[model samples]
Target: MPRDTAYLQIADALRERIRAGEWTAGARLPSRARFAEEYAVGQSVAQRAMELLIIEGFLEGRAGSGTYVRGPRRRMRIPRSRLRRLSGPGGRDNGGGTWQSRSKARTPAPERIAARLAIAPGDPCVVTSYAFLSQGRPVETCESWEPMAVTDRTPVVLPENGPLKGAGVIERMRAIGVTVVSATEIPRPARADQARADLLGISVGDLITEIERTHYAADGRPVETADIMVADRRAEVAYEITFGP
Candidate 1:
């Protein structure tokens, strides 16, 4: 916790405290003025600390309501390439692809997700959310889901636990005995919401990149679906189209 990094230090300290259950969810945090005095720092420093926590999803501030603890953050990462095979009720590979299981995670569904999955707005789905970091800083927050029928199997295997190298989702699934025949990708732009802003440490009005993908297997069966939001500043998806000469 260097002096110049005081705000981040304060935020990290508070984050740890919140995660440790010292400050329960919905518990109001100390006022900026109070924290300034408590920390023997200027009000600006205290305010910066609050902003850091807010951006990191540890705190939420309402218009009329003061800042308070929010529940655990949700982060998701799915490789763009691998085709995960759909497993039957018994978790055996059915020679068809399947989406990731819900049992591996617990996160809230974003409202717009249903449209991407072609499900009714209120329909229940299996969701997996996670954050991707490359250095110590956060890079992107991803939320992806599929109908339960597609992901009922337990322990959906992913690439070995270490950091992903050149392999993408397509390769990992193939390695696991699944094959992908086709994929469709759609792109859109959107205003950053509180959750997105917090996860990416950006402001509410910032532009974010949204990608929706639907994957199909050999028989044209929809095996998996995904919705991903990328921080515009940090990443961009590129592709090269080719035609036979």
Candidate 2:
């Protein structure tokens, strides 16, 4: 009881300080010893509070360095639509638009994903995962990974229906310097898990579509990989092709 409520209250208080500019971006916060003393809370309580702030995107910590205020949080809004398409190294048609970030727990690169980027498995990669909601209810989730060797700090703000978010993977890769020539997608059918069912508001074992895709650069090097899962009942998957030369 003491630890739970105290930690939340401390986090809430610190959240306000960041919003009020009491701590500016990139400013290092006091050490845990100082925070415990200043907040009149136990060290454990203070530590938990800091953890919460980090998750809430108010602060960041470097291993050898101390915790510091995050630079301004970027604000973005993805569009909502029924149409689906893939873009990037792999022709991953993300089920829908999503928020992308590079935080510790959710880095863009996973081992398999890094392989698609033509880097050693687990090398750093750009990552963004999207949650698709309809009428305020969750319906699907999608995640995409790109190697940092290619992205290299380029701003990746994908807007719903926007070029990067809407166009198929090949085009997006070209914009980033890689020219994606072809893609392979593997589609599979599976039952929803508890988390997927809850998000899509469907029963467990409900039919869902899972797609894993990899895109190859002009040199035949894989440039990106994506995983897309969609709720079958709530959404339909379709594709149309236009002739071009």
Candidate 3:
């Protein structure tokens, strides 16, 4: 078998055994020599398998000590239900977590962001940055952009200010008679850059999930768009769908 294939197979098998409770948390794993002997593979392949697991957050490597099973981290589920997230990121209400947002008004939208909002490039918009906290620790972060054309001069203009402060897209739009009706979220794997790592308190290059989201009004008008990031070790995203007649 190819080196890549061999290492992947070994990693998968080892992951299953670990999940099966063969080694409890903080337990030292067998040496690469032992694993190589058990799998009839080279020690290099065994080491690669161990490294994969370590990068996946399944095991921790100590400088002088051997790799050990990592303790379980909090795993919050992100519901994709339109109802749960209709308003905005962190709208699911899980874990009793709260978020704080800072909005800068009259910011010009960039080309791609303008495209997402269906507006002309450099159009004035309100840019809001959000940090969602759990136990006062940052678990997720988001950057939301709303075209000023849709909300300018309205009570809900600035996302975190005025009468409808922090009410989110759905309610804020509704308060201004915009009638938001649908939202779309596309989630993809990403690497935590320096800025992202600092926000989530993780090391750079860690795996993360980035969701591209947008809210639309009843007339198919794009009202709000955002980029939301969460560390994979911090939470998992789940899509909740309801079938109707």
The numbered model that scores best in lDDT is 3
**In candidate 1, residue 80 scores what lDDT?**
38
- TM-score of each candidate? 0.45, 0.51, 0.79
RMSD to native, candidate 1: 13.5
Backbone clash tally (model 1):
14
Q: lDDT by residue for model 2 over 191-230, one digit each (tens)?
A: 7788777766766655677778676788888766777777
Q: Is candidate 1 or candidate 3 better by TM-score?
A: 3
| lDDT (C-alpha) at residue 234 in model 1 | 47
- Whose lDDT is higher: candidate 1's or candidate 2's? 2
| Runs with alpha carbons beyond 4 Å of true place in candidate 1 | 1-125, 154-178, 243-245
lDDT of 1 by residue, 1-245 (tens): 35688887777777888889998999998888988887777778888887667655678765556888876565333233222211211112212233232223333345576555555666655555545554445455555464554433433432222243124445434553557577777778776788788877765655567777766656565555666666654444443354666
Give the count of colliding residue pairs in each prediction. Answer: 14, 12, 0
Model 3, which residues run further than 4 Å from truth?
1-9, 12-56, 60-69
Native-referenced Cα lDDT, model 2: 0.63
Lowest-scoring 10 consecutive residues by lDDT in candidate 2? 75-84
**What is the C-alpha lDDT profile of model 3 across 1-245, one tens digit per residue?**
68779999999999998999999899999999999999999999999898788767787665457888985455777666767776565564656688888889999999999999999999999999998887777778889999999999998898888997877789999888899888888889887777888888876666788999998999999999999888777677787778986
